[model samples]
Target: MFKTSLDKFTSINRIAVISDSALGFGSPDIIGLADGLCAHFGAKGILVQPDDLNRPLVDINFTADVRSVRLFSDLPTYTRSWRWNFFRLAARAVDEFKPDIVVVVGPNGYGASRALRHRPKLLVYYMLEMATTEPLYADLHKHYGNADIDAYIIPDIERHNIDFGNLHWRKDVDFEGIYLTAPINYPVPIKPRAADDRNGKSIYFGHIHPEETLLDNMLTPQLNDCEIEFFGRIGDADRGVIANRIASTPGKAYRGLQTPEDLADTLPRFNFSLVTWKPEGHIGRFHLPATKLYHSVLAGVPIIAVPNPLNVYFIRKLGIGLLMDGWSRRSFIESIQAAKAMIGSDAYRSMVDRCRVAAEGEFAWSRQVSRCAALVERALEKKWRRLYGPRKSQPALAANG
Candidate 1:
């Protein structure tokens, strides 16, 4: 029956990707996937989002033919105004592109989904998080439960199809196993490094803020050997704290923002990419993989992350990184010591080779987009068959994740 239904139609030729600038213009990984999807299917891409006008579409890598329709105003503070502006923009984008499939990124797609309620086009919920045991996840499930989306292209595979309390009863939204981590276009060559390379010469390339006690702890004299290079916006409240921390860590430098285009070339110069959450803290509730994970993976740089369920899954699954026991001074020192030993070892070289393989195969944006494209074709065919009965077409196909 599944194959029969999917055989009713052909392929997806056009796609519209909608994102919320309110949520900080989405990550570069998703934007890369969007771009790859357009190229892979030969599909015209129509991107719609809330616009700041002053800045370029931050974190997005769009192609020339991919039309961008940005609402020329700040996202309104008032709830009603926000909804009104979003719906208006969504309507305008639909009118302009008249796309075959609409890809809504994150929660920003809520308004767009409502706007496209009566339209015949298929809506894809390109989700970032999965509703697990957390209350926040339950709320997310409620949102998805109400949205009239046809398919889901979840990035993290481990989070898919898990029971979401009462929300599991709804069978309308099809779970397509299309996933993405980053656009691994090519293998980033790993530079030869000294055995002590992983000592204190690590890189941390994401949001810099207060309450990140791990970074604060790294400033201790006991942790001096492992200086971290920071590259992201520092939180206002933590400005003084970060300045002091950088001052103490002699070799450490806060390089500010680095564009995604330069990350592949820049990151391989560092020993490893740092990733740690507040220990036993509130961050453990959600199951979203940090964007930095993919950035490091794509660049052939291994990750040094505090052991969490999601972090453990990714690092172990790919054999591409090391997981610290905790954020304690002892933990950090021990992990770095282990890193030092691993550098130049055959095992380390193997790990780097594994990362390169994983990047091009499992986490490559082009492959993931191809998988999503196939899902779109199948889902649209199924929907059409249900409404108008089967029509002759090519055989149904599926993609490996």
Candidate 2:
């Protein structure tokens, strides 16, 4: 029931966002969007998220007053206990903040929605991934069935093509509502790339779960083309495996986790950013727009990856990256070697230039938030009309005659 008008409306004054995802691994898109909306409308933003005591905080800007409600300080990550805490804390936040709109982060925020269902606030779901997998699919479908949900926001419009089997979303639900595509926290004053910025390296700057993200033991036997740096943390359970993998690998180096500021600075020094998934993996099932890919593009570095349909489409279309040909060990080496060769070429600068242009033009966070703002306005306008009839216009003066 969302209006698609991009018309300006002053209905949304204050926004309350609850990032129900884990503290460190959460997608920064929702938070970034909220920041942009607040900046655009000069509205107050109250962000409720898990405590960030351990991880380095991401830098963001808000226009008006922003009150952060850090909850479940004792919980390190997503847990069963978080569900209960989210409901209680979110209800308290809404009641206290008295926001005009409440933006819930993911499917986990269903409890928070339930807490505020009786209220008249606009409820928007910022769905991170589109999964038609077994358990998650069922849970997501059920969540979509919630009658109180005003709008559903997916990261990309391309994700709508994913096979959902027999599962379907609510007919009245807003599906083609808002497309974040790939969101990035574009560095303020946009960093410029210099001739000396290419440090002859490729880097991977995200959570480390080699078992799921990387090929089995490929780090050691493969990844031989260029110096590959790993700049993110691994979970405790996988540390032993990851450490052994790094030790066995020749060119691979674990740089550990760096703060957002440090990471942004470090990214510009690299020639390319890594965006890998299993050759015949389930990564395509979720159909997410990779945040790091956009970050690398904005940093003026090409993305190197084995082709997922979405990745291949964007990478080739944007001319910002390369997709490997085959899935075998030899093919993998050949792909990395090709990337290294291109990175060293004079023509590589052209590719880097295209990346920067594409990022600033197509993948801009401002454009995403503008669309989001329109969606919010339309939702609020719907509510306004429902409660207060059609807006009245002034009567015409005396006729010209």
Candidate 3:
């Protein structure tokens, strides 16, 4: 069945993934998706992105042959034409690669539009971030429409509706809800931490913004019994504030940024994973259950999250985590206490079992890759028929032709 399913992807011989972010060492989502596509399709994949850091072109194998094209490092930082220059360079790269499919990640609609000028067989816009404001949404709509992207891959269905529901061109294009899940590289049959060994420590990983304020709340004396570790990037301006908070608090500690492998190994040591956000504004309003949620599950750790709709829905459905009653410091403390109580119980064991089950089953990226392949295949078939009429055999076509 697996081999048969992948047979359809043979027509897609080469794929070009263009993104605004760096490749190989950038967003885990981009890297994971690119890897999954390469593995599933057995295609040569080229990742094109701006050389913001001037990194050398390198090949990082995930499953199939994958290479990076770093462009536009010599342009002046203050120049307004960098975006246009990037689009031109990216289009030239896509033309040279002549990939059967082009998957654009990030908010680089104009770049994707330029790639269209080269006439890729299929153009897909993979939206990794939410359109936080109306102006941004309008801008994305304008550029994406101009790009004439064939499909969209949004992280979550709820997020798709919240972010792109009003998009006028949405119905005209194919779209799929692929959750931002953990890569399949995490070790399987996750050993659940013993109740006694949990040690009341929880974890919060990913980019830390001072505006969230939940970390600061966790430092209060009321929550001292429950230790929490912070990981991932922090801006220079907020570093002092967070460092001081961690220093002053007995149980709170700021561990430096962790690689994905390190994170996978480290997450299981904690009692719980924190997935809370301030319940206001764009982030609070439509925040989806992201990498943190799946990472925690894969590590066999239950999530203690705020009552965001997607988080609440998944937590209740999976039975792998708990949701706080509200987004207050008191509610946060209460949730930690609740998690602490369940630490050594059979209930906690059940939750851990659920996490392991989920990690290997629905939440895994392997399944998502299959879904993605099918979506791309469908888009290709439709495009093939529309462009050249129905055919008995679908042959690979030059994307630039």
Candidate 4:
């Protein structure tokens, strides 16, 4: 609907985005930014999601009218299968659309290879979660192909030196700067608490990846004090067990899926938010992009993140929220104790103020979509630069090979 309606004022030649399994892609943070960019920039955007993954999320997709955005499904059987289908359709999309650039919000080397072979300009956005403590070991020399593809990485946890490389990835431009992906671009239909609804409680939400489930015991002590509202799709069977136990506990509410509007009302009542655990792996350490922090920030609540590489790095920079060392009960308790001390202190209020600032200025989708649009525009320019460059070369790599 949006794609067809957009031709009068703007012309988005072509752009591509693929993030999750279903591909409705309308999360409050990322998709909101992407859709807003396409609309504001007068560019047409088509999101590619797996058919199997998309249908169930129709309600979520519609929450912000993202269902009206253009989309085509060539979704596959499984993730590995999705890769094959994704690249193939992506190639066809590029060929048919004849887009100025091909983009993937996450690291997509396979698509990069195709985009490079097809023409010249291929844009890749690497959303970073943790830089120093978390480690994502992609073969910089291998997966990245060559230096022609401008790489922009951020949430700049490991700014100075990290796993990727010391030398700047850009050939001549400084495209690689710290960027904070905005939370979803919801219409703000619901108003937050009118200041009297604040209640003290520690809560966390988001994916409960297998490795991070180790921290469930920490809540046993505090589950009795206040509503320990735990929400999210249980990642796996064992994680479900952990979630079920916590949810089953008295006073701990497992308030199932709440719409963005519901969250606006419900979240403001909670005094503290939780961001716990880092999986002991590459992807876990380096990239933990939790929009919950932005949610907590926006809700006027502080995040109680685990004391790991990611949280340590964020506090030192963004200066928002507190950290619990280890997902251990002692650590969580002590941290909240520290938080209580600081809550009445200047530092805590300042953190709350900073969170609100980030929610409006740094974390909101309105500003982020524009920044992303700029990046997209720049990436397309670079692509064109290489496509029509004096010496740009194209080597046709095997797609299904």
Candidate 5:
């Protein structure tokens, strides 16, 4: 209905994005941000990868008009042929999306040059995990080269600078920030269950994929008085490794993944939410953008995140959550102990309350998107000047083509 009402208007600028709609912990949170943004700005948002067989894909309530122009929404599929089909699809999207900006999720896209070639557009890449740790510099240079590209958005910028010594040659990467795509206001969850609400146990949430052995090695060894509860599913390798570690511990159990709606009710009951188990190298250290953090922040739950680049920046900037450094089972135990102690104290509850207040005031979707409109305008600067007036050059690169 909204799209129908707006048909009288010309097609607005489109943004072609390449990303994995992973549904990492099962929050289609980002899509809400995209939909909200498009509606607010009167622009078109095409999310490239939410249509995959992956369970708990980014499911969100969208306005009448919502679409993700996809590549390979599945990370496994994207990784398998990182060099193959994605390039072709990316180049094709350039021609098809007629976008003002092209957002690429990067480990290195093979066809970036092809996509951006001869187009007056900006290419925004979210260097979440790969900008820091990928081994193939040659391929990355090829992708980041000045063909059709423009700017970058990273989750791990501080580490990307420190670990890589320079991010894409110390280029202008926007670590200044990215917002979680969640609703501005959420319905408060039902009061947590008294049975589940206890500092007697700690809960760790997320999927267990084998590639993250860095996480496994860090969290497994502690046999302590602190009872640990595990939620979310594990792939085979993670199952073998994680199951073996928890076998003897009566308090450790895997409850599989739950929806964000479920977490709103479930998370508040836990003594504390464990943010992560690893903080090694660039990948482990810098790339931990768990949706859990947002939920915890919003729910006013005390969280335990590792002191990676993003978290450190978030901690300093937000002053909301707590962090642990290094992978020592000792550090893990200590932090959990500290969190447990804090949970029992008024000080910690106060900290949680403060964070929730911050979320409501600053991080809410409606408020956060105001900046994205400027980002879109930056990408379309030249176009707005040409088409809409001196201030209205449309950035839709393929418009004339």
Candidate 6:
């Protein structure tokens, strides 16, 4: 199906993906992009990441070869000196692969620079967060400014405008960037549940920060009518606290970490997915796009999100979900109440229909693959002209000759 997507760029063969987080560990975009490129172009690639022995390795069902490099230490150190060692190890793997394009995921300054040393035809940076206030990100911005990146891929344009617009690097006249949200594996077949069959169940996945997300406050008796499920990673400190809270709640459960494949089967069983974020600090202000939004839609389920501009924009644009009016616990309760009321209504069914439509079109990862290919083609064209000047017209005397 994707055979024609890269017909214009046949010269492009192999790709290299470098990231601090390993595939299926924390970086879903990296996994999707690498897998999509392989499926689209029928290209071979290599994935190089730091080996985290603490976490079990996830089996990523992709075409690329995986290489894990052990970092000097895993003690949450962001110092350039420490990261440089990782870069050195990762670069060796990348060098051996000899990719035509190098895509660096996340804010790894030394790693990005090291990848550039390979002098691939195209260098792409995929920004994971817009937390400019963080010292590590600020330091990495310096490396990003100096690196000769051919293109950039961000989660969405709103986050870029809010957090990265003022950066000097983004102002370059030649800068090329694309905003892609978390993509759903296509052909998943969205099957919206019938109204009569619906139950008042909701889900919250990804990081499970009890206090930061006000999830602790929302788990009271007021929301006893709805059943909520929690999944994904949690800090060691908060695990016991969150587990106790879930246990005390009448209809709450913590299902622990499940793979994306497993969640694909589980998501459709819920009526809505909760897209909550802390209403303050860098996370709140930047409001990075939530992967759950697409995940919900892909399963023919709607979402109930807090009042973040990006989330609100998509919810309104697609009419696939509801947004809370405020960040207080009362607002959270009200939003759930609102969703519960709409569960069996025509509006709710319409939302489900919209999700199916979106999953088949906009939310599909295949669409992002096409756009990514197009961006690479554009970059390759510019590179060709820069190396060997634009094609010249032949003399006009062919007929006369």
Who wins the lDDT comparison? Answer: 3
The collision pairs in model 2 are: none
lDDT of 1 by residue, 226-342 (tens): 567777666667576776667657656777766554654557777677886574333323445676777677667788878767678878888888998766777877886687567
Task: Name model 3 segments beyond 4 Å from true.
Answer: 1-10, 23-26, 52-61, 72-82, 131-137, 143-147, 165-167, 184-199, 283-285, 390-401
RMSD of 4: 8.8
| Clashes, model 1 | 3
TM-scores for all predictions: 0.79, 0.83, 0.84, 0.72, 0.72, 0.85
Candidate 6 structure quality by residue, lDDT tens digits, 1-401 = 35442343336678877875644544566666776665665677776766554566655555444333333456455566556666777787777778888777766623544445567778876666563656766666655573477776667666555555445555442333433434333223335565456556888887777766667656979998778888877665867877877867888888988766676677788888898877576642546677777777877889998878778888888888899887888999989988888887888888888988877777776677678777777777776666665567878776664
The 0-to-1 C-alpha lDDT of every candidate, in the order given, reads: 0.64, 0.66, 0.71, 0.53, 0.55, 0.68
- How many residue pairs clash in all the candidates, one count each? 3, 0, 0, 8, 15, 0
Tell me the tens digit of each residue's lDDT in model 5 across 1-401: 46532232224566555554343344344455456556765667766553345554444445726575545544454354554455666566666667655666555342443444435355555554444355554345544553334455444445445434444354543333555636322322223333234556677777654344334433454534666767666766446666666545544666666766676667667766667745455544446666667666665565677765555666677777677776556666677777666655667656666666666776565565566555555545543444444344578667574
**lDDT score for residue 210 of model 2:** 63
With a 3 Å backbone cut-off (N, CA, C), the pairs that clash in candidate 6 are none
Q: Candidate 3: which pairs clash?
A: none
Q: Tens-digit lDDT track for model 4 on 1-401?
A: 55432232124544545443343323444455446655765555555444454245453432222333223445554455555555566555545554444444443323323443355244554443222231221342344443554545345445323434533343444344433433332545323443334666666565554455444554556645545576665566675576677667766766655555556677777767877765455544534555576667777777777766656766667787886666667776677656645645567667777767666665565666566567656665555455554574688797995
Model 1: pairs clashing at backbone N, Cα or C within 3 Å: 200-225, 200-226, 200-227
Where does the lowest 10-residue lDDT sum fall in candidate 4?
128-137
Q: Distance from true position, residue 289, model 5, in Å?
A: 4.7
Per-residue alpha-carbon lDDT of model 3 for 1-401, expressed as tens digits? Answer: 45542344337888888876555433556666776787787888987777654334444445567876677567753244666677777888888888888888755534445545567778887877655344644564655563367788877666556555555445566888777674523212234565456656789887676656366567779988777899876645868777777767887789977655566667789989998667556642446555778777877888998888878888899998999888778898888888878878899888888988887788877777777788898888777667666457778787994
By lDDT, the better pick of 1 and 5 is 1
Residue 225 error, candidate 4, Å: 2.2
Model 2, span 1-401: residue lDDT tens: 57533232435678888875544333556557667777776888888875544654444544446666666556544455656666677777776887777887765555566666346457887766544434654565555565676776776655544523334544465543443433333324236476346788888887677655664434746565467888877755868777667756878788887755577678888887878655344534435566777778878888887666667877788888887664456666776777788866766888888887887788776677888877877776776566565667889898897
Runs in model 1 with CA error above 4 Å? 1-13, 22-26, 52-64, 75-84, 129-144, 157-169, 184-200, 279-286, 390-401
Q: What TM-score quantifies how close candidate 1 is to the native fold? A: 0.79
The superposed Cα distance between candidate 2 and the true structure at residue 221, in angstroms, equals 3.7
